[model samples]
Target chain A: MTRFASAQSIAHDIRSGKRSAASTMQAVLNTITQHDSAIHSVTHLFAQQAMQQAHAVDAMVARKEPLPPLAGVPFGVKDLFDIQGHVTTAGSIVLRNTPPAAQDAALVARLRTAGAIPVATLNMDEFAYGFATDNAHYGITRNPHDTQRMAGGSSGGSAAAVAAGFLPFTLGTDTNGSIRVPASLCGVWGLKPTLGRLPRAGAYPFSASLDVVGHFTGTLEDLRNIFYIMADTPAEPEPQDLRVACLGGWFAQNLSPALAAAISRVCAHLGLTGTTELPQTPTARAASFVITASEGGTLHLPRLRAAAEDYDPATRDRLLAGAMLPASTYVQAQRFRRWFREQVHAAFEQVDVLIAPSVMCEAPLLDNPTIMVGGKPASARANLGLYTQPLSLPGLPVLCLPLSNTGTLPLGLQLVAAPGREAALFSLARKLEQAGLAGRYPHNTQQAA
Target chain B: MTSPPFSDEVLVAARAQAMELALPPACVAGVIANTRVLQNYAALIRDFPLPDTCEPAGDYTP
Candidate 1:
């Protein structure tokens, strides 16, 4: 009944009769009651349903039936997914008129099939469009490490919920850096699995090409467990000796001294041999924006044209601008995607995994909007996902591993591998976590407001 | 950066071609202003001599 015991740990405890499923549920409910008023990470709770699910898991265990990996573990889902009996708002007021879903998303169903409980639907950016979960519609999802600073988004609430110890794990969607950025900001581990590795049916559509469902966890063991249950791959053993490539040039350039120092420390610890000099990422980032805006713009053109005022102003103009993009340009963006993936794939010849800073800087304050990283003024929304967007282009599996300490704001280091090689990435992450290179929300960030 | 020869009216015409929406005259300026970012990306692509035969990933229909 530990509030922050991982899903795997909770399941083990439940199976071993150390804690009843009801007791665990009570602990979670108590934690939410005690902490959520100021945190507000959860938007809506399915308390009764969660208890029902947990009890069913207990009954199964009592019958001596083999339990699923996530049996009796409570989970928080991002607001964007369609959970049966709840409205899938995706954090926008425009969707207020939509009716409750009749069924769960394919991913949600898969998790439930594995015996995980959906305790609540967490907050997110409107339409999954922003970097910070500072939605004009949902207010803002604050960082658990520092309430004043932003939790990277549009999966901010999911990351913050796990970091705040309300839930040991949560489900979120990453388009661009939604999962990784928040994982970095909140000092939690998160994974954006290979595209189509998990089915997307019933999740609200963003950009078809880039949208990926991901999960957040406090430790690499939880991250790997959740990923194994979620991804379309066989789990592997904990990492021993695997070659890691430190991405240089575009991925490493212009990072803040603190973040650069942190990445340098991680590399030094790993004894990483650098490889693969990527071309300038600014062009790749700009190209990614074009792809997202144009696709997102087209997808919402009807709503945009009729109820433009209903959209978040931050995303509104971008969608409208996307409506104006040339067909040839969209085609060009796709061509660039192919070329970029090929370029990245060619690098795998020399190394097993690639690593980079998840973001160029630490979480910025939500109230004070503009961000300055490495002496350059950056758009708080667009620039926060700088290290993440290009990888999203090729639909690679990337893990956001948090490296910051107790008193400091969180920063992340990203590990990526070949599309179906989630086991490799998880293996490496587990090793780093064991070495104390990555972990949960730091101790100082654990204070309740 | 010099503004592209393409004017706001032309870009709006292209947007209008893709969708049906009556825009206020003032709105055309905003779309074009925001689209300047795309032009910067275009400039970046222009720097690379992409092979004419290059194809995009996931471009083919399943």
Candidate 2:
């Protein structure tokens, strides 16, 4: 197995003339061609265009021109993001005949401008609805750690690609744990920045209010650097001596012994003595779900009416039900959302960051397709977002960090902060990484002897 | 959570007519099951007491 390099390391080598950009891009494409079959993470590869872009970066370097921060780094996007002249299928066949996108999505355009080449479009849950990336259109994306288990999707492909070491980073969206769940299961560093912190133009919509575009990377530094580049903002310095707390109540309930122990170790390392509770967490989670269903259903109602047969059976059924939701219910969900946001903001007054488990356990087996929720076997597709959904209600920044040395499949911990305080999350995650408690799960071939 | 406001028969009818959904007969059962789940979630948010002053999150100016 190839040892994957971070975006920072790749750019450093290219900029110093230690390696040519074309060679790096070719290697990435070759790796995807050779290895991606086992994981099924990539949906479409842009080999020719990516190679041309890599040559352009090399030309600039030869001419002694200033290089961008991400010069020649290869990245992938969830199929929902539009790349110029390419059809954005959004992991479904319904849009197969649609005209090619005239331009890149807003964030994609930003990454391109910074010299990161888009090499492929990754698979996702059809229409970004389910937690499992079991698209009827695109075959299910199996976890790279263990092919029989799920990758924990709608952004499963994005996480799996990074976990498989095929790309330095890949873009994904988090509406209701789409990014976090997959990142947790795949053991990659994923960031769902504060909602609205990154632009979303040209990306296919799921829930207008809940959708957040983010990315997954194998390194914490890469996650932070790429986030600032996409946001087009200068990095904010992380404040020292930040107060942190563990979340209890709903977040504390479900746990595999390994996951619970991991969280305890993190808390112990942070010296946290007690846990903070999010008020009305179950209700908050419920509100997030209702709002997502209503918005997503409303957005796709016209398409469902016209081409209902073109959708995945699972997605079609869910969207049909969401469309039938009473108007009063959607209104109430929004109302409750406003109230909940205020309560969450107030809770942030006492702690700068909060730590919680990203998923209850490791990825569930594809054959069983269930997770132990509240001590009962529940559908993984429905309940994988139990911890992530409530946090989504407030649109806070959450960094899903993979726990190291857990002696099992990947388990992730969410380092959450108030809106626009991603620096705090980065700060906390870095501390954990330095302490040998958090990092990417090494693939079998890359693990030390 | 409170009980769903509509009966199963009513919901099935509403899905076809009001929602303009034309799911196959086999698909109807799954749609109905998912609708029940959404309704349960909606019920949890519906009863939160809010003043008349509370406004929906529209275009967030901030």
Candidate 3:
């Protein structure tokens, strides 16, 4: 078996008596013990809990009890998510002292119910704020492909852990591309479910409107299985012909040459037409920022006002600015969100899926002086979210599939489906993966470069 | 319905009103520069023509 086969394949083996859940759990724990020193993907691992859960699953198999959907699979949840009895740090010291959660977050609880054990709480950007997973409190989560490069943020640790083979798949949240960007940089497949399709009752809130619970898996089958289990609602109607539209304008034309080439390769592989003109995305990204700031500021106003010093300096300033936004501006930004979502739907009417670069470039070297794109100096913060923020506004289910060779410190093309249409997205992705079009893991960039 | 841009003095006052913890002078300067990003976004939204039927985001009720 491939060491990092998708969870669904592993589950099939476990259920068919070819592998025991206990053996899979032991293998995962051994892998983490052997490999996590350099990657630092998981912050707090529950070795005892995972083994205990695995033992129970094995006993169920022996007794001929109905197996759970994800029986014997291991996964990681971002630290921002509540996993019951652990501190939900959200990758900062401020919440480190907070009381343990009485129950798992909805997403975590769902994973458990599916028979997947969350082996650890992975690291993330502070409060899921930044695009680079350079947490001040927790050391940065290094890209598994190249130790020196970054794993895209907020969900970086989740992506890196999967890339490094610590787990087959992991759970993450996306508010403005946290899930997709990191998945792209880390060379794995991840999905951002449509907003509200997965209940957000327990995950740490970034922006109520934009924040979405998503997951990272290496294979298309795993993505489909996990998505079906995670989404609170039933599957929606599937689309036929499954035509994908290439989104150009800001994301495609303005992307770095390397990223543009990667997207081109993905389009060629899928036999999709590349278009030059698409909806204005830069403006949509701008609108998303305004809304995120206003809502984020409001969410953290009390804490920010009380102990601003406790927050990471980078996120602290952003929240403080959010607190200072005029009410009218906040209202206007929300109004813009509605219009933007409608415009996104308009684009969907023309195609079943819209494909674009997950980020403007490949993973940049850690601590680079400045991030430059296409020879143009850009906001290190703003540019990371440029390709992702527009889709986040509408809470569209986005699947990020890596395109470059494993050693290239991979880039990805994003497939965004219409709202609440995750099944359709998965169907298309499965088609691509079956045709050897989607990217997969074991992408060891370290050996090549 | 563009809101009047807040001056530096107003920003400083707002900072005070918001009870920002004592930040380093350099950090304060950085905040000012970053806030400009926010203000530009504020202007973009303010300039857009929003539908009259647009509703506030919150818990829905009958």
Candidate 4:
């Protein structure tokens, strides 16, 4: 069987006599062990525990007990998510001596209940701080499509593992585009649910106000199904008629030629002729940055004070700067956020889903970590969230999906909906997937483990 | 935005002193560079006009 199977198909195989859960788990672990050398997506593997869980699934099947929807499906958690008994390093040495978690993170616990096995702890930016998963403690998570290129962070490892077909799905957290940017760069399906819609318990905190718990999947169906399970909500109907519009002005500025052309194709398919623009787009992005830095810096202030040397140099510097930001700056940014949120919320009155590029371009090369912004080179680490940061300001639900066959490494698009309207995002993503306009590019050719 | 309230080195030294957190010699340069980035962002939203009624978005005042 091809290792690039989706979670749905894996579950089907396990439920039927097509494959044993134990064998499926072994194949997944073996694939990572043999193929993850270059990608560095996995930090630790729960080999023994995963195998034991798999055998139990096989037993359940032999007994003819009803199988769970995701029975025997293997997935990975971003290192920051607590996986009971394992010390959640959050990709830093500072928490190395911290106690092991008493219980699974809320979402992890939910997946475990659904019979999904947590197979590994994935790599990420330390404490989920930077956009680049260039962790100081753990090595960088290289893009599966092009190893020399980046897998955007701080959720880089989670995205790369799915892109590599090492796991069918993986969990990630987004605060100012952690989930969207990497999923875009890695060419996978990702969802940033409405702020606080999903449980955040046991997941490591970054920015209290902006932080969100989400996941990345290889296919749109798995993305939708797993979300409902984690949300503990019944599946909502996908609306057939969606009021869709492409975002303009600030969102329209950057173009990588190919990305611009692809966007045009999707807009044309949707019969969209004009674009809707958000008010004061640049300032919105600035507000997102300010809020995230302030909250994240404040959250880690105690630890930073005690053990600043334990942090990744880049993360430490950013947190240090964030901690010292004037209280007025934080308050003013929040005030701006209120105004900006109202403006966007009003825009939703006319449009059901807004379309935008997830990243300005495909993943950047590791050697030259720069992206073209305003026709000038800009640091990828800082500017990768140009599109995503603004959206985060309003706590809206966004779905980032890879555009298929862009003739390069992977480029992605974002489908945004009003708060609590994740169903709308999925409906539009499904239509694009059917149109052959959005989906993951096949990576199984290189290492069809 | 161009006229920052304080010099980077001066502000860092003062903030460090007030918080009683030691700024390691090696970390100062990186911290200053990052602070400069934040200063530019702070400038962008610093003076934007907002209605007096606008409260901090998610900030709850009990």
Q: Give the number of colliding residue pairs in candidate 3.
A: 0
* Candidate that would win on lDDT: 4
TM-score of model 1 vs. true structure: 0.93
In candidate 2, stretches whose alpha carbon ends up further than 4 angstroms from where it belongs are: A1-3, A447-449, B1-6, B60-62
- Model 2: TM-score for chain B: 0.70
Using Cα atoms, each model's DockQ against the true complex is 0.45, 0.70, 0.42, 0.61
Worst 10 residues of 1 chain A by lDDT: A440-449
Ranking by DockQ: 2, 4, 1, 3
**Candidates in descending TM-score order:** 4, 2, 1, 3
Where model 1 places Cα greater than 4 Å from the true spot, the runs are A237-239, A273-275, A404-407, A445-449, B6-18, B24-33, B59-62
> lDDT tens digits, residues A17-109, model 2?
988999999999999999899989999999999999999999999999999999999999999999999999999999999999999999999
- Quality of candidate 3's docking, in CAPRI categories? acceptable
Docking quality (DockQ) of candidate 2: 0.70
TM-score of chain B of each: 0.49, 0.70, 0.57, 0.80
User: Which residue pairs in candidate 4 collide?
Assistant: none
Q: Superposing every Cα of model 3 onto the true structure, what RMSD results?
A: 3.3
Best-fitting candidate, measured by DockQ?
Answer: 2
lDDT of model 4 at position A134: 98
Q: Which residue pairs come into collision in candidate 2?
A: none
